[model samples]
Target: MTNPLKKYGDARKERIDQLAAMSDGSVAVADAGTIEEAPGVSLIASAWRRLRRNPVFLTGLTITTLFIFLAVFARVIAPHDPAIGYLLDKVRPQSNPIPGPEPGFPLGADNVGRDFFSRLIVGSQQTLIVGVFATLFGLTGGLILGILAGATSGWVDSLVMRAVDVMLSIPSLLLALSISALAPRPSQWTLIIAIATVQVPVFARLLRGTMLQQRSSDHVLAARALGIKRSSIVFRHMVPNALGPVIVQATIVLATSIIDAAALSFLGLGNPDDRQPEWGQMLGQAQQFIYDDPHLAFYPAACIIIVALGFTLMGESLREALDPKSRR
Candidate 1:
């Protein structure tokens, strides 16, 4: 009461002393605006960080990488030429003796005595090529149609959407089957085109919806206000932003493409040359000997399953990374 200023000074000093007593590591102090915020990480980097922590993503990445490696180095990795069959082993009747894994042929011999391991390694190339190219063709066509529809209003949007709807009305495999059947020489190229055709409507619809949403976003509005050309805004701004979903979808579609290629091959629409050593063709050949040598079907089927699982896991993980809402 007698000296109020003295009491206030003592209280301030006590607080200061308390803070000073705290260890530097224990007490973190920063000016309001001067505190350093974390550096901005790019979306890809952030996604990668998150993916690294995920088991599903890791498994998928590993399998996919292994398959890609096999596809690229098929010749180098394969122990024997896929085309050369064991003529002596070919003489063994399916009923008398069914081959199992042995020296040189770790995965055993197929119905025609081809080295199962060698054919499998070589077959990866064909599967990957078909999946990749078919997806590319479909994606390109879809992007064009979707961008056109999304950038323009009125009749263009209606026409494009309607066409996509019509295509979607039919089953994808059935449509692909019909297309492949109609081709004059349903080779690998024809199969690719058929699978790609089925994929077009899927990508078109996805991009169209994505573009419609992005068309009115803040950045797009800003670009329009800045007198940016419509084409530039559409192609440069909207399309780029909308590609996240497309990329995820493309991964999933690739798995489907591989499966479809296999299916077409299984149905006798794949490569006519037996020497090509495709997984589906192998399965087709193994059908008759399923009872005697089920291992023949198991190998290719397992490969297909593993490859599809890899793509699926990767796609789902990517979807979770890209969309915050899905994280929950």
Candidate 2:
């Protein structure tokens, strides 16, 4: 019947094919350099290049990298056996003994004669372990509690927020001390749990406020209008978008977590085994000898300070980098 509609469809198809062919030819002629200028690749590459240019970020990154490496390779890097005490050279300060010294003494020795250097290295392991686990536990607990509270307002939100407020009112150190004392000995699991509990309320309040702000955004309204499941929208869309601040906060929390764990260990509420050469234990055992061989306390204390500062700097750098207002 020589239909007009059939002819129009065939003409459109031919035009599309011609356009596609022209596009392919253009692409081929543009060369590899042109193709490499794709938006996603250039954006990531530019960000990486910019990151390399920032001196503060680079310095923080280097310090953080070294600590992470040491934390991972503590056992292998440690020179002297952490557990073994060099009793023959006990309480020897930084001052070297006679020229032909017996067994070459290190920065003195701890109360039990453990190598202070070795103990410091080993302590990194416990500090890293507790910090990572406790931060994860607290972050997860906070996210869940926050979502539940914010997603459903009214009495549920009030109750959850008030509970967080109560937790926040108590001093973190005291709360940790009471909890550690009441609970079983500070095994890895117990310490992790204790630190997590103490830190969770802070994260909860932070996340709840962020989530509440997000809940009223246009995208959230659109999602609701489109009949998207509330759970999927909150967990997938909302949470991911609001994660920038949370991630920055988490890093700072990690630093604080390490300090808290060390404090607990120093107070003797940490790991049960006395043989384990934790930093805090070394410092605690060095109390009497502070005057005799200050290095005994100072060495471990210095290690803690350095590691904590590294984390703090990294967190600050990350927050600065991620925040648009901060950049301006």
Candidate 3:
């Protein structure tokens, strides 16, 4: 009897050839406009087209760009020195005071009479820095671990996955807090590392799962059958294909990292200097006079919320765009 599997494969190949021939005939009869619109549209290009039309994506992109600009030009744009405060004003009686939105101080002054607007402008730099670096650290670590686990099998995969599981078992905030506690002093780098440590297992697990799915796909199997090096097959074929979810996750993680960093700072695990104009530290200080000057708390809290919202909107939009079901 003829081999069943070989016969099935031959039949499948013949069917594919017939489909190709049909497609060619259809293309030949198609209008020029239809052909032009169909051929050049790649996955990324199609996604971009979809994103451009999405109002949520546009809003997020605008807000994110504005924050980035504010972070970059903080020093040039800030009206006054953020560190200096009006001690003279602080010395005055509590009943009589210089109120907010005063001349030269658009957003008014903090409890110590520091320019609230300037502090907010400068604070964006520190907040963005922490979010960005922490995300980078986490993404880098996760990519390495995910690739190692997904590309291998048996003991190697088990070992890496077990470590990921252990990390995941811990509450993220608690894990970050524990790590930050180990630092001798509250520092920016310490906060970044702590947040990043919490984030690694998340990204690693996501990428590893995606890679596992991709590895058994026809393209990966073909590459392996072609005698491609294992490293090339994994990196060149597997990683790139699995990166869509990772990129989307990175944006969401960035927002979380910023919030986590702010929480760390609020808990007094930030810079030792009270004068530093980080948003979380500012909020920490404002809590003492919350009833007295709610705006002090409001401004920083608003900034944090707006920034995080921007990242979240963008991440969600990207997720929708990348989803195959959404395309259909």
Candidate 4:
């Protein structure tokens, strides 16, 4: 019988010969083994690529993108006339047909005969505006106050922290309500201030804590030892490092701000003269139709709920994406 060792050596020699022939017989490889591929891109790039792999994230992103587009182009995208009132059609339920010869309204008409679909489209503008402004205001105020408190740890920190503590102790909604009630009718700016006020304490606390933790890190210490200006360390170095959490928090706060703004608007403080086509105003108007035509209220309520949910889901997805600890 043929020796097993001789057979193994022949197989190995054949493989080497095949490789040498492939390389034009110019070079010979004594031993060849499987080679592993090089490592992929950076963590962020890898994370992003992996994120695209997730169907849930993609679906959420698509929904959010569509909603944003709708909000941005409400006037163009709306099927019916948002402001035009159909004298013939009023209090039409969502499930009912349109107002015509066998007319069918996909979304139906409100108590005022306004197209529910159109109004809903316009309402997106209000939510986006409120969410964006409230977040900006909160982020701005938080950054300013947090930086001040964190950089200075003496009486300044104590004062700022105590103020934040006091604000935090109060119920955010209650505080907003009190301010809304006490203030004269609110303009857009007024509403922004009210929402920002509620959000500031939360952001301030978050940023302050983050700053405190980063203040003593090696990079910060090294910068200090290198004679880097304190301002440079705080703004350029520390703030950037601490921003991951801030971004996640901002997304969440944006969603909360939208909901809060809607609540306040529902209470009559939303639009100055109730002329604006805001979701909250629609909600307020919806209340009047509760006993009569429930559809008027339902349409707006559904829009608010849906938009709020979309924002919440987007925010949560953003958090998961940005937070390393949450990554698999």
User: What TM-score, over all chains together, does every model reach?
Assistant: 0.90, 0.79, 0.86, 0.80
Q: lDDT by residue for model 2 over 1-91, one digit each (tens)? A: 7989999999987887776677746554325356354445543354456667777667767877888899899999987777787653543
Q: Who wins the lDDT comparison?
A: 3
- Per-residue alpha-carbon lDDT of candidate 1 for residues 1-328, written as tens digits (9 for 90 to 100): 5699999999987887777567564544433236557999998898888989999989998999999998999989999889887734544673545466788878777656678889988998888888999999999988888888888899989999999999999999899999989988768899899999999988988898899999889999999999999989988999999988998999999999999999998998877787877888788888988876788888898999899899989999999988878872
List model 4 lDDT by residue over 104-215, tens digit each: 4565666556677777888888778877888898889988888899888999999999999999999988888777777776766667778888998888888889899999
| Span of 10 residues, lowest total lDDT, candidate 4 | 95-104
List where candidate 2 sits over 4 angstroms from the true fold.
Answer: 1-50, 86-105
Candidate 1 residue 234 Cα shift, in angstroms, is 0.9
Clashes of 3: 0
| TM-score: the better of candidates 2 and 4 | 4
**Which of candidates 3 and 4 is the stronger one according to lDDT?**
3
- How would you encode candidate 3's per-residue C-alpha lDDT over 1-328 as one tens digit per residue? 9999999999997887777677856643224346344556788888999999999999999999999999999999999989888433653446634346767878777666778888899999999999999999999999999998988889999999999999999999899999999999879999999999999999989999999999899999999889999999888889999999999999999999989999999998877676667888888888877877788888899999999999999999999898887663
- Candidate 3 ranges beyond 4 A from true positions: 1-37, 86-90, 93-99
Report model 4's TM-score to 2 decimal places: 0.80
What's the residue-level lDDT of 147 in candidate 1? 84
Counted clashes in each candidate structure = 0, 1, 0, 5
Worst 10-residue lDDT window for candidate 2 reads: 96-105
Collision pairs in model 4: 97-104, 97-105, 98-103, 98-104, 98-105
